[model samples]
Target: MFTNPEQFANATKTLFELQMNTFNALTSKAVDGVEQVIALNMATAKNSVKGSVDAGMELSQAKDPKAAMDTAASQVQPAVGGAVAYGEQLKVIIEDIHKEFTEAADHHMAEAKNTLSALIYDVTKNVKPGSENAVDVIKAAIDNAFKGYEEVTRATREAVKTVEQEIAKATAQVGALKPAPKNEAAE
Candidate 1:
């Protein structure tokens, strides 16, 4: 539909630049997310190693087998709590990354759709008198494509929301973990 080579080249260049920008933004987000995860892992690992060494020392200092067993048993609740905390922290990181990625993608998609629609409009404006039907057909096809894209995006968002809800529920349950009452354990 382009009337001139120059116009066509310009449009192509615009599209290419938009796509490259989107790609770069997404890549940066991914790198940031990975860095956050790595930092969390490193911190968790250090704490875990320290906790293990302290627990070992306590167990070793026990005067009898029963004391040693009791020392080990007391460590269970803290270990579970630490694990739950770590999971929650990881979840937060992942959710943040997801939110940022979704925003970036949505922004890019909107920009692309607008740009393409404008380009199409510009190209169709100088149509030959007898080519009105062809222009209409082209416009209809583009409209339908955009509509389909919208529907898919909506469904995907709902799916992600449901998944996030489930994760929250699971995390809550894990966080609620508790050791049995001392009386009950004694029985």
Candidate 2:
């Protein structure tokens, strides 16, 4: 449908560049997310190691077995709390990445749509008189494709919302849990 070789070449080059840019943006976002996750894990691990060492030292200082057991039991609640906090932090990071990806994709899709429309317009400019029908058909097909893409994008957003709600509910349930009493006598 291109009017000339130069137009076709330019269109191809523009589309290819758009695709490459999109790929690079997405890959960079993924790498940043991975780095954030790794950093979070490293910090968590370091804290966990320190906590264990401190607990061990405390237990060792206890004069009797009962005291040692009590000390160990007392550490359980904080440990559980730490785990819950870690889960919350991880969830935040994941959500951030999802948001960034969605925004970037939306931006690129808009750019691609504009580029395609321009190319189509240019091609249609040189259409032969008898080729009006073909041009109309191409326009209709492109419109339908755009509509389909919009529908899918909406559905995906809704699905992500549902998943986020479920995660929040689960997190709340975990946070609501109460640690076991160390000694019934003390309670």
Candidate 3:
């Protein structure tokens, strides 16, 4: 029934692209959680540093006994250490999340490619003997399928870039806090 080879290629391409987009969308939601974790870590780190610096300054200026400064320093040290640990752990989490998405995408992409190949095989096998028209139809279908894949991939990549930008912004904001003056009395 496939008279136009080009039309068949287009259809196969459309189907593959459609499915790929659906796959990316599902993965993105998962990736977003990782982004949030990173964001939260960053925010925590910034706040910890700011709080520590503020407390240290206040204690140091109070002319509090050496013991008071020591005590405040001791308290701040653990918060700093915790923030550092959390940030590192978050990085590992993001890497793992990305790995998972890549693996899933690879598997689905292979399946879609295989489905295209199978369709080609079926068209070439079951068609009436010496059907030149069928071969042409199959070729056209394959070509269209590839074109669709390219389009969908390009569009989704742009979207992914946008998400990446958002992630970056969120992380950057986490460390944007201004540090307290090293010499408070000078002001």
List model 1 lDDT by residue over 45-75, tens digit each. Answer: 9999999999999999999999999999999
Instruction: Looking at model 1, report the run of 10 residues with the lowest lDDT sum.
Output: 144-153
TM-score versus the correct structure, for each prediction: 0.77, 0.77, 0.51
Write model 3 residue lDDT over 96-144, tens digit each, in one string.
5555555555565566677667666656765666786857776676757
Q: Which whole-number lDDT from 0 to 100 does residue 180 have in model 3?
A: 39
**Model 2 regions more than 4 Å off:** 131-186
lDDT of 2 by residue, 1-187 (tens): 5666797688678767877776687678879978998999999999999999999999999999999988998888888898789779878987988798789768877977897788778768889988888778766765665565557557656766776677677767777775865576885
RMSD per candidate (Å) reads 3.5, 3.5, 7.7
Model 3 bad stretches (over 4 Å):
1-10, 13-18, 21-30, 42-50, 53-61, 65-76, 127-187
Weakest 10 consecutive residues, lDDT, candidate 2? 141-150
